[model samples]
Target: IENSGDLIRAINLNGGSTMEWLVDRGGGQQIITVTPRFDQDAGRWLVGILTEMVGAHTERRSNPPWVALRDSFVNTWELLVLVKQGMSGAFSQGSAPQLSGPIGIAQIAGEFTREGGLAGWLTITILLSINLAILNILPIPMLDGGRLVFVMLEWVRRGKRVPPEREGLVHLIGFAVLIGLIVVISANDVLRLIDGRSFLGG
Candidate 1:
């Protein structure tokens, strides 16, 4: 490829797949075949090669507001699809997905900020926000979706609402369970850190 961006895009499009490259190393050209693997720490596919910038190039262009909005919608939809697929895979595997608690998230934020500057920080921030929104809407007790479920039940009962005391008890129990889950996940994060494992559970 002519540039790092092109190479990265190609790799991402290929995912973890084998690829062949033709290269000239002053002794004529040669073909190299390699396979990429998914790196949990890096959160991408890698072939264990590094590139250095020989020069700097910059280009600036402005897109119409409509175009930018369209792209934003498209990207958001793609992210949602990926999240759905990941959740499906995790369920099918009969194993819990790797999760990051506060400590792990903080580590990721710092790494991204250092490695990618403002763009990287903003990207991570946006992703976290999206994830949080999704969690908030999940049909778990003590969440908005849980309350919506109750509302639906009320409608099914011809406007007969659930007893206030019972609803409160359910929410209180939910809160306790949620806190317990947080504690457990946070403890896992600490143990991973002590073992020098990636906070991302690599």
Candidate 2:
């Protein structure tokens, strides 16, 4: 590539590149080996004037486990907050949060894989786990949080407990609502994808 930015993006300059150069004289064409010159100034470097081959290989080191876990937590927490805001109409004036179901999760997982490979998969997995953990603890019927609600009520009553049948019915209805919500969100995800919309601004 003639442009340094292109070269850097194609591969790290510190790693250098093995390029084939074509030199043409009236007699014929000849191929030559060319090496890129490194510059201290950012984006101020050249690889070749006319290049036949422009490529390089790189070895990426994944972040340490602790760092990865920490980052995953931060990212998941941010995502949860964004979801909450979107659900609460916080972004009704700007970018809306992209709520996804199974299909959306799978699509996003594929994207993460394309962008970052195994690390992406691991990161998304951890984030999903975090989402599940937080969501399950929310004081909503059919969730662990819902059960906790009854337990708290029992404590407040000193010794009395809510009837098991009533609790079960409440959770049963909640389960149905959760399932219906999932179906609706999944349909939305499919529609958004069909319309070629941006998930970030959905």
Candidate 3:
């Protein structure tokens, strides 16, 4: 719920005046619609309240006396990890979606803007952010989440570590796969642009 609230707030900040409620359909499909009650002022107020709560908690911990500093640090670390996991889970699903390249995203953004005005563009931006967060947490080599996983394995094994050569190879493979996906998506974007279905007034 917190993550959803944050996403809503971000969309509002980006000039969205309508909320598009989405529901999952079978087999990765979704049903979405724009609602009338998502006024910008209400969204901003919610964001401000959440921000204040977060800031107050941090300030209280920071000003604690010297003797409590270590305990505070430990608590803060645990809280941070929980928050991060929550955020990651909010963005991720069991499988990856079709990845979009920069060109594809630009095309989609423009299309949305043309179809539904500012609110549509804002919705697309929010979804893109969620997609980006999910992609980063993938267990592919060279990503932060992948490194974190390796560290966990090392801890569990009490001494064993992933070999440097194997790690390098994994990263290289992931990089190549990512590049190929980008190329394919970009080509699709170009074709869509030529078909006049992408971008606003193109």
What TM-score do all the candidates reach, one by one?
A: 0.70, 0.57, 0.46
Best-matching candidate per lDDT: 1
Write down the TM-score for model 1.
0.70
**Taking the tens digit of each residue's C-alpha lDDT, what string does model 2 give over 129-193?**
87788789999999999999999999999979999999999999999999999999999989978
- The regions of model 2 sitting more than 4 angstroms off are 1-97
* Model 3 alpha-carbon drift over 4 Å, by segment: 1-99, 198-202
**lDDT per residue (tens digit) for residues 106-147 in model 1:** 888877787789988998898889888888888788899889
Candidate ordering by lDDT (highest first): 1, 2, 3
Specify the poorest-scoring 10-residue window by lDDT in model 2.
Answer: 37-46
Highest-scoring model, TM-score? 1
What CA RMSD would candidate 3 show?
A: 14.6
lDDT scores of the candidates, listed in order = 0.76, 0.68, 0.58
TM-score of 2: 0.57
